[model samples]
Target: MIKNSDITVVVQGPVVASPDRAMDEGITEKCLTSVRHHLPGAHVILSTWQGQPVEGLDYDELLLNEDPGSNITEYTADGKPDASNNNRQIVSSREGLKRVKTPYAMKLRSDNYLVGDQFKFLQASFPERCEEDRFLSERVVVNNTFTRAYARSRRVALHMCDFFYFGRTEDVRALWGMSNLPDLAYDQTRNGQKQYWGAPHYKIDCTQKLLLVALQQYDASLNVEHLHDAPDDLIARSERIYANNFVIGEPELIGLGLCSKFGPQERANRLSGRLTYVNFDDWQVLYKTYCDAEFPLGMAPLRIRKRNFLRAFLLAAKLLEEALKRLKKKA
Candidate 1:
C-alpha cells in the first residue's frame, strides 16, 4: 500500500519570493542529500519553474559530475495539498500507512479545513505556535486529552455525578436545578434608585462570555487528568455533535446554507448554509471502534456509551472536508 508517491518528504515551508531562486534550490538540494543516505533511490525534487520531474539524463550513464536534472529530484504529490507541511507531503502507499501507527498517526487531508476537534485542540496546545502550523498539533492534543479524560472519569461513573453541560447550563440555572453559573454578576450598583446590574458592566460582557464558553469547552474536552480536582462534569457540547436536534427516521439529511448578509444583515456579507447532522453517536463510535472497541470496556455502561467530546473533533474535520469538496467542484 505504501506507494513510492505516498512516501514524500516535505521540502520546506512557504516559498519565499526572492530575486534569486537559489535559496529554494539550495534548500532542496540539502534536503535530498540529507535524506538520501536514509532513503535509497529516493526522488530528490523538481525544477524550480515547472514542478514536473526534469528529464533527459541518466546520472549513472552520463555523469555531468552532476546533471542538471539529477541535482533537482522530483517530489511525489498526494494529489492534494499537504496541510501538515505547507509544501505537498506525500503519504506512503495506503499499504504503507500501517507502518506508522502510534506516535506518528497518519491522516488524510479532506477538502475542508475543519478537521473538527483537532482545530480546537491546536488552538490550545500551541497557543504560541504559528497559526498555520496547528493542524497536526491539534489532532495530537485532542487525541491525547481525550485518552486521559477517559481514564480518570471511569471511577465517577459508579456514582452518578451532576454534569453541567454548557448547552444546558442556562436552562439548568433557570429551572433552579443548578445554582447560578460559576461567575455570577455582583450587584455593585444596587441602590434601589439605580437598578442592580448583574451584567459584567456590559462592556466586559462579550469578553466574559467568550471566556466562559472557551473555558467550558476547553475544560470539558482538554482538562483531562491534569489536575486531581479536575472539573470532571465539564460538558462542552459541540454544535456538530449535539446535532441530534433534528427529527429521526428522515431519509435525506436536509440542511440549509446560511444566506449571504446584505447591508441590513447582522452577520458578514456572505451566505452561510446550515448543514444537517447526518450522523449520531456514531462519531464517538468511530474513535472508540477505530483502534479497538474501548467504549464498552469502561466500568460504567452509561459513561462508556456516552459519546464524550470526541464527536466535536470528528464533526469539525468532516465539515471542513465537505466544504473543501464543494470548492474543488466549483474550481
Candidate 2:
C-alpha cells in the first residue's frame, strides 16, 4: 500500500513547442489531471523555464530556472540541440529536487502521460529488504535490438528508461544530481564512445548510462528494475523486430504501436482504465501481441548504403553462438 504522503510527483520540461498556446495548455492540463487523479493526495511539483507560465494545473510547488545557455554539448554540427532535449530535463529535474520533501519521488516528463495504475505496480515492486534498495522504471533498455546490437554483442548491462522513474527521494536526487549534460556530451564526443545504436548517442542515452555507472561509483547498492518481465524468447524476438524496423527506417513499427495507439488525449482516458482493470500478467500478454505482430524477416537490405550487410550477418552469428553457449551451460 503506497500512501500519497510517501510520494511527490515532479513534472518538468518546456511548456510550448509551437505558437499555439491553447494546444500547449491543453496538453499540460491533461497531464496534470492524470497525475492528480491517479496519485490522489500526493504532492505535485512543476519545474520549467523561469518565465514559462503553466496555468490551471493543480500543483503544490513550482520551481523555475533561468533560460538555459546555448552551450548544450549534444548540439549537431549546425549548433542545434538534438531533438531529445536532454539538457532541459537535467536543468528542470535538478531544480525540482530541491523542493521534494517526501520519502519517495516520481520523476515524470511534462509530455509523458501515465496510463495505468503505475503507482500500484510501484508499491508492489518496491524492494522490501534494506539491502536491496532499488529504483523502478516503466521500461528497460538492454543491448538486444539491432539499434543496440553492438552493445548486445559486448554484453553491456541494462539501462533505465529516461521518461519516468520512481525511487526513494534520496536515490532519485542522487541519480538526477549526477547528470551533467554538457560535460557528459563533451566526454562522449571527445572519447569517440558510442553509447547508443543509432545516430550519435544523444545526451539522454548518455545520461542514463552514466546514472547506472554513478550508482557503482557512489556505492549506492541500488539495482534498477523494470515494471514487467517477459520470457527470454519473447524478449529476444521483440528485439529482433525492433532492430529490423530500425534498419528499414520504419519508425512506425517501433515499439509495436504501443505508444502510437494512444494519442495524448486518448491516453488520459485509456491509461486510467487500463491501469485500474488490467494486471501485470495481462499487460504482458498485450506486449507479446505487439511483439509478435512485428516479426522480422531474415536477411533484409540495409537502409544506409554505407552500413554493411555482412557486419549485421556476422552479428547474428555471434548472437546465435552466445545463445548456444548459454543453453549448453543450462543443460
TM-score for each predicted model, relative to the true structure: 0.19, 0.52
> What is candidate 2's lDDT per residue for 204-251, written digit by digit as tens?
234334444445544444332221222355345433322221111111
- Displacement of residue 281 (Cα, Å) in model 1 is 22
**CA-lDDT, candidates in order:** 0.23, 0.47
Please list the Cα RMSD from the true structure of every candidate, rounded to 1 decimal place. Answer: 25.0, 13.6
- Candidate 1: tens digits of C-alpha lDDT, residues 1-331: 1222222222221122243221233332333343343334433222122232324421111101111221111111222211121112121111122232222221211110111122212222212222221212222111110111111112111111011111111221221121112222224353232211122211112212222333343244432221222233432222111211111111111111111121215222211211112122333333343323434434433532443334344456666887888799999
Clashing pairs in 2: 115-271, 117-275
lDDT of 2 at 7: 83
Q: After superposition, how far is residue 187 of candidate 1 from its true place, in Å?
A: 44
lDDT of 1 at 251: 12
Clashes of 1: 26
Best by TM-score: 2
Q: Note the clash tally of each candidate.
A: 26, 2
Candidate 2, number of clashes: 2
